[model samples]
Target: MKGRSILLDHVGEREAAALMVDGKLEDLLIDDDSQPRPGAIFRAICDRPLKGQGGMMLRLPEGETAFLRQSKGLRPGQPMLVQVTGYTEAGKAVPVTDRVLFKSRYAIVTPGKPGVNVSRSIDDEEDRARISAIGHAVMEGIEHGLILRSSCAGADDDDIAEDIAAMADLASAVLNDLEGTEPEALTEGDGPHVLAWREWVSAAEVVTDEGCFEDHGVMDQIEALKSPFIDLGEGHMYVEATRALVAVDVNTGGDTSPAAALKANLAASRMLPRALRLRGLGGQLAVDFAPISKAHRKQVEQSLRASFRNDAIETSLVGWTTMGLFELQRKRERLPLAAILRGL
Candidate 1:
């Protein structure tokens, strides 16, 4: 329990995966089989463009529609390939993008962007050069770009080459079906089990048994996420989701010392990302930190920056509001766990 461990299990009948680090739940992925999943590739037909939004609606197979925000030079009925980018709210169009990427464990093939690049985290010059050479060789004549992931740093050379080649081949195969007239799905996105294997590349013990969730305490952790209150030892925070945005209110509890406000604010900031990730909460987030002096604002901001830096979801710190609240805009990548587990 000291190191990382991946729990491959289910919440009700849906496939689920959990990342446990040192006995704490670090991340969670659960399947929502009702709609087109994020990262799924589809050949769609352009429907119509929004007047002032500069975006277009796409018609997919089975009467589903997606919204593409960067639709320029696109005409109605034009056929094109698109990839689902994120989850959709009820009755809302599935958000998609024309920039389709074929991602695997070690490589990501970027169509229309031709370059061989290594992850910036791999700081060793020799390792970067080696990875670059492998990518360039595997993608010599291919038009698609290749990005070597950070996991390739100490991985076997043969495995890295194989992964790159396989993703490139898959991308080519999918891109070639653009001539099809009828809208259809090219590839379904990876399920929770496969996604955990692909994204959680760090060394960890794998648990695939049926009762792994209950055995490893993942079920208990998930139950805690169902509530909005989070205990931070010295203080607590309430994370409430509204239709417009998520509201986080931090309290110093009984601590009334001069540093109590700063302490509670820092604790909330450190735990905020993990809480949101577990609950699959996104969109706008407004945090009402306990009252602290203007001089301590920088410290709180830095804490937030450091906490969100490691989060996989895309989040932008939009700075402080006039009312002294912190705001953030996060991409809605996954369905809310409560919604997924509803009625179960």
Candidate 2:
């Protein structure tokens, strides 16, 4: 991809960041830059607690139960470390383990759970092995996981080790400050578009213009969520997102031939994911493709996965339901664009 630009509009009551890929607006990030983001470690007091299969649901002093796998030993009124994961659809708190993980340009240092993990982006087998070994060596005796980022591919292990050590000292300083501070954010995650910009357009120009949406082409890139139909050249897609799930239907626009219909369905399989991501839609999503033979199902699934491969968030393409709709789930971070824009 060519170099892009970022526009940050913060003049309004809410702040929004727009990412332009190759001079075209691609993603919108709505976040309050004045406040701290998620990933901050906090000393939270537990309220109510319940154990679930996946994790424990413990209400914290911040007024939301944290979804954590290691909440087994936590009890009510106890001060424990917690990290803000993100927000839910209803603006509820979602907290994770207090394990402070700091992401540098080259690596991620996890100071809470000591271990070694390599990023999935590094595909080379030998490189993966070498980075993992280096992580293990550097993280020895530390209660944290050292993740070798893809940027560390050609990096020297000694340099990476030094970076890890430096980050360890930073984490220690933050922890030491917790001795006096109450429940509050110690660090913040980057804005959604900021992360997207770093991963997709590293050298992109950044500008802040509160009036750029109507003046520039920023509005063109955002998905008009209220409009259910999305034009896809060969065909158009009708998308409906309820509180429970998101449903999308593919239909041929003008040409009704079987070949044309198949082409449209294939196009929908590829385009829908991008549309959803642009709209920042997440949670359960189901796509109803134009009818195709059972033999073609595998091909459609492959196309869908390939289309979603570029997304930063984790997306799982679950198999078709009994009614033939394809099921998938995307990890939700913040509210969708529609809600944020409409002040919902």
Candidate 3:
């Protein structure tokens, strides 16, 4: 199908389940596909008159502080190598250390605003030759004196071209739409997952003989759904939040023995941190395991340590509280997926 239908349920014990897939609840619309959106970041010369800098400015594909340098090294008007120092503020491009700083804002290219912005109204020749190589580009913005990620290796001229084209196309569409219709439009490009999977590889070492796929992403997703408990039946538990000032409550559901239940809780604890990372939850966590013996507490602690073997985020367990709480903390810079799910 050209599109996927996602159903999210947040009303009852049955949290989320997909009923209809493509365009039907059964097997309809399973063969069609849609085109992917073109995404890019451009790098080009800035030839704009800055408010206080000078006659020429350097702009990056995404930053603001353009590296301002004396115009004495290269061609007067052409594209060259640059770096992404920092983003622009009100009206400036900030560059980093070791730069060819110049007095100019990066003029983000597009199909509409194709040329380098020289002033409030002036523009220079479009770097069409270099930009056309990309499939379809979009110029996000023009910024102050700075270089962009385009200077990095693997960011070919094709990316620049694609970015320019995308921006141009969007601008044209906006103008056309505005002249005859609505003024507000939302357009989003590819995101982090696309970038992360750019160089992903996988292999299968062990699997059931019945039906196993060669690609690991499939198993990985399935494993993600299963609870870490080795023999807890097919029922799986999903958690929300990555790191936060939160607490975990335990219930055996039907387990009877106190120590066994405690051991099960310990097993569950071992999996909690992993879920936190997967859900992108961060901050403080106070987990209360089922009341068990001190030995089981030790086991839980050890399991907690084991689960964090490959975490990129920093975490610390302050040991259990006198009241039987597992105190821990995870630092973060953004809201985790757990929060997103809960909020939804």
Best by TM-score: 1
lDDT of 1: 0.93
* Highest-lDDT candidate: 1
User: lDDT of all the models against the reference?
Assistant: 0.93, 0.69, 0.40
Q: Count the backbone clashes (under 3 Å) in each candidate.
A: 0, 4, 50
The C-alpha TM-scores of every prediction are 0.98, 0.79, 0.36
**Candidates ranked by TM-score:** 1, 2, 3
The candidate, 2 or 3, that scores higher on lDDT is 2
Local accuracy of candidate 3 as per-residue lDDT tens digits, 21-120: 2332211001101111122122335545344543346543434324445444434344543333322222444332223222111223333223342222
Q: Candidate 3, residue 3: CA error in Å?
A: 25
**Alpha-carbon shift of residue 7 in model 3 (angstroms):** 19
User: Please, what are the lDDT tens digits per residue for candidate 1 over residues 278-320?
Assistant: 9999999999999999999999999999999999999999999
